[model samples]
Target chain A: MSNAIDRGKIEALKSMLLSLHKGESIEELKRKFKDVLETISPVEIPLVEQELVREGVSISEILRLCDLHVELIRDTLRSSLLMDVPKGHPVSLISRENEHIAKLAEALNVYAGALSKASSGEAESHLKAISNILAELRKSRLHYRKIQMLIFPYLERRGITAIPRVLWGREDQVIVKLRELSTLVEKELTHPKEYPNIAEKAMEVSREISDLIFREERILLPAVWILLSEGEWVAIHEAAKDIGYLIPIDVEWASRAKLLLPYEVNGVVTREQVESLPQEFKFAALATLAPDTYEVRSEEDLEFETGFLSKDEVEAIFRHLPIEVTYADVNDRVTFFSQSIFRKGFARTKTIIGRRLGYCHPPRLEHFVKSNVDDLKAGKS
Target chain B: MSNAIDRGKIEALKSMLLSLHKGESIEELKRKFKDVLETISPVEIPLVEQELVREGVSISEILRLCDLHVELIRDTLRSSLLMDVPKGHPVSLISRENEHIAKLAEALNVYAGALSKASSGEAESHLKAISNILAELRKSRLHYRKIQMLIFPYLERRGITAIPRVLWGREDQVIVKLRELSTLVEKELTHPKEYPNIAEKAMEVSREISDLIFREERILLPAVWILLSEGEWVAIHEAAKDIGYLIPIDVEWASRAKLLLPYEVNGVVTREQVESLPQEFKFAALATLAPDTYEVRSEEDLEFETGFLSKDEVEAIFRHLPIEVTYADVNDRVTFFSQSIFRKGFARTKTIIGRRLGYCHPPRLEHFVKSNVDDLKAGKS
Candidate 1:
């Protein structure tokens, strides 16, 4: 009975897309989309879209239809398709990150709005605001990097191949464009004649940013929602903490999360209970995670020729260091790196720590890394 | 009794050094040195030398005398001052490494001799030989790096500060010269006119390598002998196994040690008795090591996005890769590296793994790393 109903919805999806393609009225398409949406499941949506493509709708045309579909189903999505998550979940963190990014995008749009006006005339201040907001948005690179490193690798491991291959490449391009736009805007700040050139790039960047937000919400999140388990979500969040959020994480918000809240009928929680419970519970959650990355050392202090130190002191010193240091041993294993606190010289994570350097780069460039290492070991270079 | 004897030797050391500076004969100085050697242990050697310096002997004059003093007491020195170590101890490994280096130096000397003897006839063969040997000698950089990463850091920790600071810089210079010498020899191969330059650089490199061996065995070893405990030697040896020896380690020699051999009266121990008793006892030896660096993770496999892997597989895969991977965590701590199989790229250790990146480098060039990281993170570069 369910199979027959899905088949009917798939047929309806094709005809609605076909009419939307034939320049049907927005009102007519919305009415058709709303009626069909009632019967369509998330799993069937992809199958229906694939069917529409086979029936001669171009991917670009379908992508346009997808945007319109979102408009018609937006209210319904809020109630059904979008799953609400408790705090500390990966999806929840990603959603919060997306919300932060949206605010940054909004600020950029406001600045661009004033700049577009012929006589707004506060060019210097407007440029400053543009640069500042762009700088804030630039930190989205960290969020993207977390996805690339912590999330995508896990997705790839689970045989979810397409997103990492396609979306990962696109994400890298986004960061590159974001960097170029920042440089272009900074140049315009110094030279007024360059404003037109930078303005064009800035507008391109803005559109790309808007499109990225759209794809992440409408496409990326939904795919990830069903794929990742509760445990994997917690692991990603643990890794994400080291990468950090764009803004200061709200301790109060995290402390008062719903799932962990004690059930009470108007009973006041004590200060001691409130302060210690969350952290205690958080550690307990992590302890249940896979042991590999979170291997807690049994010993307290490391012995050296001079004296010994706690692990925390050694880690603190590494962070405080001015120069970044990395050590790859004789076998060419990268054994350690001093992550600098002053600036992020490069992107790295625990997954990359043990990954073959060959696999680290794209397949096309893998041979280059291989040859250089050979030449170096052979003392040819 | 020991303190009174040491006081008497300190006075003798000053008088003998003054006489040596004023052109005393070897016979005269040897007689005085023999008597003083009875009272002076390795720990007291530095104090005796300091007394000589205060009594108006120049450091250079004293260093020259120290070499002659070693020659004078060479035979007696082995019996008295040269402390023996167990088969698998760090000192024994260093001795074996030294023996291997000496053989390479000897080969280089022989090759250089033939190349220097008025031979323009076999330039191709000679260049190949030079290139081959120099390439072999370049692997000494791994040995030198081990000294820097493993030994010097420990020495520095033990408050034997001056030698590590001075020698570490000099060792870096030797590696640099070795690289330059290789380039010069390569140019000589292509263009014959570069032979004079190449020969000069080769000679300098040859001298530096020989001098390094002398200082390490003579000066460094004695200092280390008194300063490091037996447990420390084994710990260093364990860490050394990961970095590896310059030559293939002879397991046979390591297995057959004398000190731990029972004072048996014509009775050979069986394999079962040896295996069980030694392993059980060795644990007791390692149990005393300062725990920080040696905190081995008990779990077998590391959990990744795709699946789980034994730490052995992760290490094996890391070793086989062409590229080197290092991860400095968000806190800027040197966390881990994959030492690759192709060529040794960088030197690292468990101690340095947790160390601050700031302390790894010199202060003067610190800002270059800091600024570059800032620019990268700011998306300004």
Candidate 2:
């Protein structure tokens, strides 16, 4: 791989990548890659790849030069894998795990801030706070470890591995830093004289954790652009459906990638290989695989059919809605409410569930409550 | 008078005044006016001498058994006169000639969470929009007439008579109401068409001006309150100072009588006598009678005093401050900036004033600018 050859290969690859548009089929991507590779020496491939991975390419530059459809890129890559990808997909599982880790990082930051502000004499109080925050952070770490140990092996087997390895390393650094800060905080709790100094160290640890978050957002996941295929992402998404993200909401993908295989490979595929394909692929294959094995629809079709949510999944989905929800019965009694940590005031189901609407009012203003409710129900005041 | 007679006279005066607080001066006031009265009846004395001549008071049936302090009662009467009588006093002058006649009622309800959402419209566009707002409402007629004919007379007598009564009347109302609706806007020219329909009735003559403002704030002000006070509020403060209020800031009363005398006069002192007394004799003779003789305090005793600013008043005062000022300047290049109506993005005397240092960046590299500023400034970076 001479420098001249590598530079030419990089330029051709960049041009091809820039020309790629949204919704291009697998054949289009393969053709573009093949054309660029044919003109380049094989030895230059590694250098070209590394150059593409380097940072400092401004987002504006990408927006201006990239031929890939912005919306498609965002839809496939930025969307949460767990929510958008099909069941049993590898990408979905990774996304859900990443989300859990992010939540843990946030919780740790809160705890670290609180502990730093705590007095040395209040050791027990600081410990309790740190324990709670660390507990949440630990949950994220456990989720991350699951993906690194259990999930990455399958991706590595398929040659879609480098991105996860990088992210996992970054995650380990965060865990080590957090552990060190936690120990320092614990020691300071027992020694009143070491109050302010321990706080400064805790803040430094919190900052490092924040930097880890930045790495995940800017470097780690973005590197996945060169890895996960659409079908794998769909499969991982489906497999991770049961796993929960820290702050759940509908996740959006960043970009979509299509995979292509040669005709010779298709002829060698077995029944098991076909069965293991993603749901979308399975449906598409069944539609055309054998005309006698599937029914055909003749009427003009306007509606699209999709997967159904299980009862528990439906409940979980509502629980993870972005906006807070509280409902009162027709009788004006509190029936249910979502318990969000960021809630402005205390709300306990036990205290409010069957309580009369008037009970919520301050003692001096019970009449005002009854009157407002009556006014709402009645046609006239 | 004998001690017993003096005590009896005090008690009698208290009874006459419906047993209100009988301060130390009650007997003296009673004795001074005792011989001049046409009637000696306890009820008649209060109605004639105290109630009619000074601030009026009516005895409630519920107060029959209460003991009264004469000095407290007199002080109350004095303060009431101070408030209502001072048509030309600083407080009265500023309050009475309030140019934004329509917003006056709402301004008074500041304590009740009203009139706090004041804001100006956009730079070039908002000025025209606000002008259209004022012209469309045609509220200036009634608002201006009321202040000029009804209110300015009283304010003018107090040496506060400088602000162009008509012009300021128009500007003040526009500035205040514009400020109230400024933040609630989705666009510079078009305000929300709902209550406080600032966009629709730019200058409609309606008594419900305050009501409209209150309604507009219910939606617009809260969102503005978040950033407006902390960052952008400085700009509004600077602009407000330059425009100046409709009434003068420092007022000199026409006469002490305006502050200490009630509207209705008692027949105790003949009108001829009051008229015949020299102006100096009226004030000076109350305690000492020599012309041009006055008690003077030494310059050493005249030290500067400081006081706290109420949250709303602070906003008002800051808006009116002479020099432009910005916050966190050494860190960011103009994160917040103040552009006065007179100045075009530059402060005349205080350039780079009230601008968050960060805002000075060229359009293309804002992020780079921010990162460099943040890093170079250490934690502030």
Candidate 3:
């Protein structure tokens, strides 16, 4: 159902963008904005913002689009909660904060309803509850300011600049009005005769904050989805922990949520594949073969293979031959041995195959063999 | 004069070879023998033998051709030196040997010259001188045999198989005839009445050896020119000193002849070039550069340069880099280095450039550096 809605939004957006003129007037842009809000889902606003940046469109245009987006989400959520909210959801802290604002909005509506019914005592209690919620809401402005100033810069660097700035600006405006309304409410709360006026101002502040919450959900979160890779989102999630969320969480669920937050969204392998591979083999395939082949030959028979000859062949050959042949693979692996039968001793390939050629000999002789072989192969000898 | 004759003979030989039919009878071959002799120079006889071998031509055919070649050289020298007795001329040795054989032939032309030459008091003195000369020649045969059997095999393995075999075979046949004639002389000296028979046999052997000298000069020497490199010729000349030459020589004149031999035939530099080059740059130019460049960079750099860079650019950049870099050039020479800046205090480029990189380090650290570079480049670290 979500895919179907997203596909319809994509088609509508394509048609609306194609119809735009070179020098579109503000009135034409406003009409196009209304058409987009009417046709497209609120979740797609951040994707459109990210696409605009990718297409090299100006950040200001994306911000203006975000403003239109906030209004659509605010209207949509007025009659019902956002579809994203679920009980104990990973983003439930934001949902809880939204519920508090919704309750405040409901309390203001109740007071207004009571005033219309001529119950002045019930209106006075509703107005007092509204003033207390406004005070609680004012305490969150500093937290929102941190996101605006500090967090937005990081997102901007990642090209998600426009939506955050627009949403943060609207959030700041709401905070300013809430503070003003709180001041008015304190003045009126001391004078009970002005309770209706205080309730009206409190209602205005709650509505503005409700609009900001709608913008955060519709624009900001979707923009993050479009702009950030899974790894970057993980980093942002980590940094956000220092600044406390508006609502608390169960520790176990939070940890699980952190794990699920796609650490490598662009990764080719699924998380299971990465976890299943042996750690030693992770980068082993990237290694190249040693520069030279280890050749072992028998003195008794000149019939020996060029590569990976047996130790028996090497020993038999060197025993009878007037000359000696010693080899190191490109990896410098000492994978051969030639023991003379006259000397009555045995030399094992197993002891040496993985060992370095140098360790096969006494330290004094190692340098000579290396330099000689290097010179010989290089044709210096 | 020899070069012009050789070119003319080559053209005539090509025509003769083209006219010859497959499976021609011996009588038909003998009928064409004189024409063949006129066309083929003595020097080309060995090559013809080799060409016959390559063509899978019959051995009897090659032997017949060789016999014709011997007759051609004998006839040519006889006619060419008929009137000439130029003392100490370049060809004086051949002229003197020819005149002695001609004198013996002339003596046998009349019964009086033959009987008096055999029975006169001067005949005994002449016979004794010939006997001593024959003994000296016999000793020289032993020396020549030593070179033919032992030394020529070494040259054959060095890819110079044809000329030595042909020259040695001719020398061996001449030595066998001389020994037979020497035995005849010993028997005749014991019985003066049979002097005519012994003297006739002596004349025939002397004529055969004289013809052999002409064959050696015209064919053997020129064949050697084609087969042995200048360095190999010099080595043969050096080895010849230990064994000694067959003919008595004026040491000064022989030394002058040795000096005149072309030492850079076929662009093969003489032993002098090998000795003249700095011990490091003695072989090919590839040998000079490979070791030096190999030493400077790790195997990683080798892969990068070989896999990506143009061959010329890799060489130029490697030389231009500030640090001294020596590689065991493909010839395994400590053959490469760059100019290092710190000359007086630090390691000097002059001191280390052509020196083996391993040798430049102290004995204790040499193994460590090679192992470390190998390990690092191999991604063992």
DockQ of all candidate complexes:
0.03, 0.01, 0.01
**lDDT tens digits by residue: candidate 2, B1-381:** 111223344444445454224433445554554553213322222222222112222223212212122122223212231233334333333233322432332222221111112334223343343444444334333333333322332222221223323334443565455445444433444543342344333323222443333222222122122211121222222222233345444543333222110101111322343343334223322332221111111232211111111223222322433333333333232212222233323222111222233333222445787787677558452
Per-residue lDDT of candidate 3, residues B53-98 (tens digit) = 3444433333344334444545564433223323332233333333
Alpha-carbon runs more than 4 Å astray in model 2: A1-107, A110-118, A121-124, A154-164, A183-197, A222-226, A234-381, B1-381
**Chain A TM-score values, per prediction:** 0.46, 0.35, 0.41
Looking at candidate 3 chain B, the ten consecutive residues that score lowest on lDDT are: B288-297
Best by lDDT: 1
lDDT tens digits, residue span A1-381, model 2:
243444665676566555543545535655656655455432233234335434223222332222222122233334242244443234444444454543444334333444445545544575666655665665565455444433443333333334445556666666676677667656655654564565556545545554554444333343332233454443333334334344343554433543221100121223454465444333433344321111111132111111122223223332433334443345664333444434554332322332335544333455787787788568444
For each candidate in the order shown, give its overall lDDT on alpha carbons.
0.52, 0.36, 0.43
lDDT of 1 by residue, A61-107 (tens): 54444444444334333223246656555655666676666556544
Candidate numbers, best lDDT first, in rank order: 1, 3, 2
User: Lowest summed lDDT over 10 consecutive residues: which window, candidate 2 chain B?
Assistant: B258-267
Top candidate by DockQ: 1
The TM-score values for the models, in the order shown, are: 0.34, 0.21, 0.23
